[model samples]
Target: MATKRNVSSTKEEGPVIDEAIERNWEIPDFTIKEIRDAIPAHCFRRDTFRSFTYVFHDVAIILALGYAATYIDHLPSAPLRLALWSFYWIAQGVVGTGVWVIGHECGHQAFSPSKAINNGVGMVLHSLLLVPYHSWRFSHSRHHKATGHMTKDQVFVPHTRKALGLPAREVDPEGDGPHSALEESPIAMLYNMVMMFVFGWPLYLFTNVTGQDYPGWASHFNPYCDIFDSNQVSEVYQSVAGLLATIGLLTYCGQVFGSLAMIKFYVIPYLFVNFWLVLITYLQHTDPTLPHYRENVWNFQRGAALTIDRSYGFILDYFHHHISDTHVAHHFFSTMPHYHAEEATVHIKKALGKHYKFDPTPIPQALIKSWKTCRFVEDEGDVVFFKN
Candidate 1:
């Protein structure tokens, strides 16, 4: 493992920014291989049976919740049924989202060593959730490759003042502008929560809504979209086929069980899964304390380090499969399975020391903070930090 040198000087030479984020700006003394070496070898190995166990476990809970929700649908009181249904959807939906995470692991080749098993399982699982697996996998690889690069990063790239057509000094440096007001407003929080959790995922995939722009428009579903090159077109077509097959299955379900039944049992939970997916990714990357680098300053270690580790409490962590809390490690080592992320993250944190970011800001507060303050990046720096 190659070790970095002159870390103290390197730390000082980096662009000056928010002291909070600048503290982590210095290149660490340890290298990626050293960080990997700290983790037990077993942590890097994929366990196919164990990975499948997690999938089956989440699916079992989803089925149980669905059955229970159906039984509660018979309740005499409308309010009781409504409350129970709401709880079931959130619970089952979150669990189903974990299923999606498992498939995502398959995409990263963290689920197993066999590419055939990974693609087969990921395609089936993501397709069931109305996601195009190969399409996402290809684009997501781009994201991991260039995580904090202001221009090259694929998703959740903060808009610049120019991009938003605002003047350079329009946003107050003192943090008391309209953005601050929005941050403190309950209505704004509610509005942001609604948009982020409800429509954020599909809009992102369909239109590249929060993503960085290519030469033209980009959509994950289009095989010919710039998101993929000609070499990768066939795989994207396979992804489209998976999506079409899922649509056919859902249509068949609607015909057999009635549209309302389909909505009650599947659609609501599907939306919830999307909500969780969007919320997780958004919060992971968007933070005032994180920096976005232009090409000249961006490096893989810095880009990967830009991710924040969030706590969703114990039960939510289980439902999310710890993706929220262990995301920093995942970014650093994309193929590390969720089951091993905690261990790897612990080692990385110790190795990285002050550079490791673990934000204890409650998720709701963090969401509001980012929505308000992380609106855009500095207009003219090689290393730009977020501002309102």
Candidate 2:
């Protein structure tokens, strides 16, 4: 045997080059081909059968949970029954939201290779959830295409105080003494969170609450809305029809089960679904590390790289199909099936090295931190990062 050497004397070098390169926001020398080469060829292939298996699996659990809630509602013990029912709603809501993620995959053409199958399933699932599928699909596509573009991004376009006709001094308050008017008071924060979780998604869809500001009133469901062009009118109308059908279905359910029963079973869980949707998207895009770029500095690769990967715990990861964790890869290859996204993400992390942003912070803490820190950007630069 050879004598043992003191290898500990020679230390590993830090990733200094990678760290410096990550901060270089101009453009990257590394091409997309390098990333593609890192991933296995099989990861690019979509298997419709396997995709449907997940859809069916999530649907079965959702139905079982719904039935369980009904049984729990009939239980005699008031406090125990209420506790069980609350747990059931939370469970069903999360599982149902996972189903919505699959529908989103369909909209991205990742559910299957067949566009017809993708559209058909997406329309059904999203419509039942009160999302106009075609309308959301088109707008979400635009978001992906222009992810980091400040002025062009369709959703969560943060504006300067001046743009909103508020004084800059109001946003950047005098000293560290008191919070700015834009800062939410503790009670107000709680109320805002409740309202956001309950009605944010529907309001955003119908009224463009946090979406891009258009010259006139803009609504996602309006076929002639500036978000869509003339060619998209038919698809928008189809989406409208689907939403109308879902409303009619809700009406029938209310009539049969009574309003309170309907609210208990369907409405509350629906709200939770919207909450998950908005929360996931919000956290994915809005982070202090990510910079929003103007047209002069924006490009597809840089825009796509702005997304962050988050950990949502293993059990929830399985339930949510790893959407939170594998979001970076999803942005890069939007048509790649969710089953393959994790593997793809591993390869991307390898390729991106220090440039890949993964935040392991617990979601609640992360959410609060982002809400406090990521208010708005300045009006003067080609690149803008969040402030206060």
Best by lDDT: 1
> How many steric overlaps does candidate 1 have?
0
**Candidate 1 lDDT over residue span 95-136, tens digit each:** 998999999999999999999999999999999998889999
**Going through the candidates in order, what is the number of backbone clashes in each?**
0, 0
Q: Which stretches of candidate 2 lie over 4 Å from their true place?
A: 1-29, 164-184
Off by over 4 Å in 1: 1-30, 170-185
Deviation (Å) of 239 in candidate 1: 0.9
Tens-place lDDT per residue, model 2, 1-388, is 1112211111132111221233454344466677788899999898889999998999999888888787876778999998997897788888988989999999999998899999999999999888899999999999889887877788888765457544454355442222355455777678877887677888888888878887676888888979988999999999999999999999999999899988888888887888888899889999876777766556777788889999889988889999999999998889999999998998899998877889998999898877877777656445666666
Q: Each prediction's Cα RMSD? A: 4.5, 9.4
Worst window of 10 by summed lDDT in candidate 1: 1-10
- Highest-scoring model, TM-score: 1
lDDT of each: 0.82, 0.81
